[model samples]
Target: MSFAGFEDDIGGWGPPVELPTGSGDIVRDAMRKEQVIKEILAAQDDLRALLSRVNAVQGDVDKLASGNATLQTYIDNLTMQMAKRR
Candidate 1:
């Protein structure tokens, strides 16, 4: 899950190239980058929370399925007993 070694392989890269632009333009670009990063991180957190909830729901569904199988077995046994008595 870590990209730690990739940095060494791609290291020694020159600084990012920048075209001449007004100071206001540079400030706005930096602000936009910060906002985008924040939104992306927040979205990741939301997805993690959603995954946890989905796992819990799956557990509940499994329990219900097990209970239904037990009930069906009981019903089958009862039906066979009544038939034998008659």
Candidate 2:
């Protein structure tokens, strides 16, 4: 026998059985929760990317500071030589 164009199997393993109407709401709630989890994961990925960029900028700043300190030492040595010649 067939109902709604689906043949019923004697072993009760035919097409999927329909859920109760009230269960539909539960399924929707579960799907919504899954969507929220996905959004939270995406936000975490964005934060990680931002942190990586900040770290890169900090490394660049450190290099510039080191270069500046080296230049200042060279200038100080030149000033001392000029003063000795005076």
Provide TM-scores for the models.
0.68, 0.67
Evaluated against the true structure, the overall lDDT of model 1 is: 0.87
Model 2 per-residue lDDT tens digits across residues 1-86: 46796655644666676766645588897988899999999999999999999999999999999999999999999999999999
- List the global CA lDDT of all models: 0.87, 0.89
Q: Which stretches of candidate 2 lie over 4 Å from their true place?
A: 1-24
Question: Candidate 1 at residue 11, lDDT?
Answer: 31
Worst 10 residues of 1 by lDDT: 2-11
Poorest lDDT segment (10 consecutive residues) of candidate 2: 5-14
lDDT of 1 by residue, 16-78 (tens): 657676466888989888999999999999999999999999999999999999999999999
lDDT of 1 at 40: 100
Tell how far residue 32 is off in model 1, in angstroms.
0.8
On TM-score, the leading prediction is 1
